[model samples]
Target: MSLFEELLKWDKDQCRVVGKKFELGSWNKLSEKDRLGMIGELIDLLCQRLKIKDKPKVILTTLDNAFGAFSPSENTIYIDRKTLSKGGILTACYCST
Candidate 1:
């Protein structure tokens, strides 16, 4: 099956990780608009999970996809499987934007 399909099958007990090595230069290649768009999507996902029918409280936890050698950028946001399942969000799309 495809990687996307595999990730789609992930359950609360599973952990998703990225094994590729990335450099700041690679990230810097993206336009500022693209970065903002990515960040916005993450924030929207958080809002969806909090079920913000009007206004809601949100707690976001972020981490690198790597095992332990690297960290996400200061601005990157993440959610683990455990927290994601407990949250009200019904679907997840990884690297899909």
Candidate 2:
């Protein structure tokens, strides 16, 4: 199955496997650059699939209520750092979707 498809099959707790597939080790072991790069790749993948010409910017922050949010007005996607720290890129991608 495609990575995205595999990701969709996962629950929040099982999402760390997605990071391992990308050779990111564990979420805590991932570096900032790698995390951002993964997010960028997922966003690009999503945009390409949707035929979206303008890719949105990704912002990582601490959030209490949400895992991620996409703002069409600013063409930006905001991801909670806690999600990354705990669930890794797969969870981020799932949240973005």
Candidate 3:
């Protein structure tokens, strides 16, 4: 299989493993610290699933017309804080992927 196909399959498998632990909409009720931790975990999971070697740092910030943004200079991801309700952290995870 092609690399993209492998990664897509990997992501689906990982999501199955993760889904067992988290119910739909469960990402919303976590505390800020827990949410950040979860985001970090998602990043790690994405790295493994997508085979990314250089993982970018994640930061939450206000944004306009964007769910997430990336800074190549600093190798960081800026997640829109406003979008983080109702399983919104999944948006951040998608951005990481």
Query: What local distance difference test score does each model get?
Result: 0.36, 0.66, 0.68
Shift of residue 38 alpha carbon in model 1, Å? 0.5
Q: Better model by TM-score, 2 or 3?
A: 3
Across residues 53-73, which tens digit of lDDT does each residue of candidate 1 receive?
A: 433223344435621121234
lDDT of 3 by residue, 11-77 (tens): 5556755554344467666776676677777778878767799998988888899987889999898
Clashing pairs in 1: none
lDDT sort, best first: 3, 2, 1
Query: Root-mean-square deviation of each candidate, in angstroms?
Result: 13.4, 7.3, 4.2
User: Clash number for every model?
Assistant: 0, 0, 0
Clashing pairs in 2: none
Judge candidate 2 against the unseen true structure and give its global Cα lDDT, from 0 to 1.
0.66
The runs of at least 3 residues in candidate 3 whose Cα sits more than 4 Å from the true structure, single-residue gaps closed, are 11-13, 19-23, 91-97
Tell me the lDDT of model 2 at 34.
72
| Alpha-carbon TM-score of each model against the true structure | 0.30, 0.61, 0.70
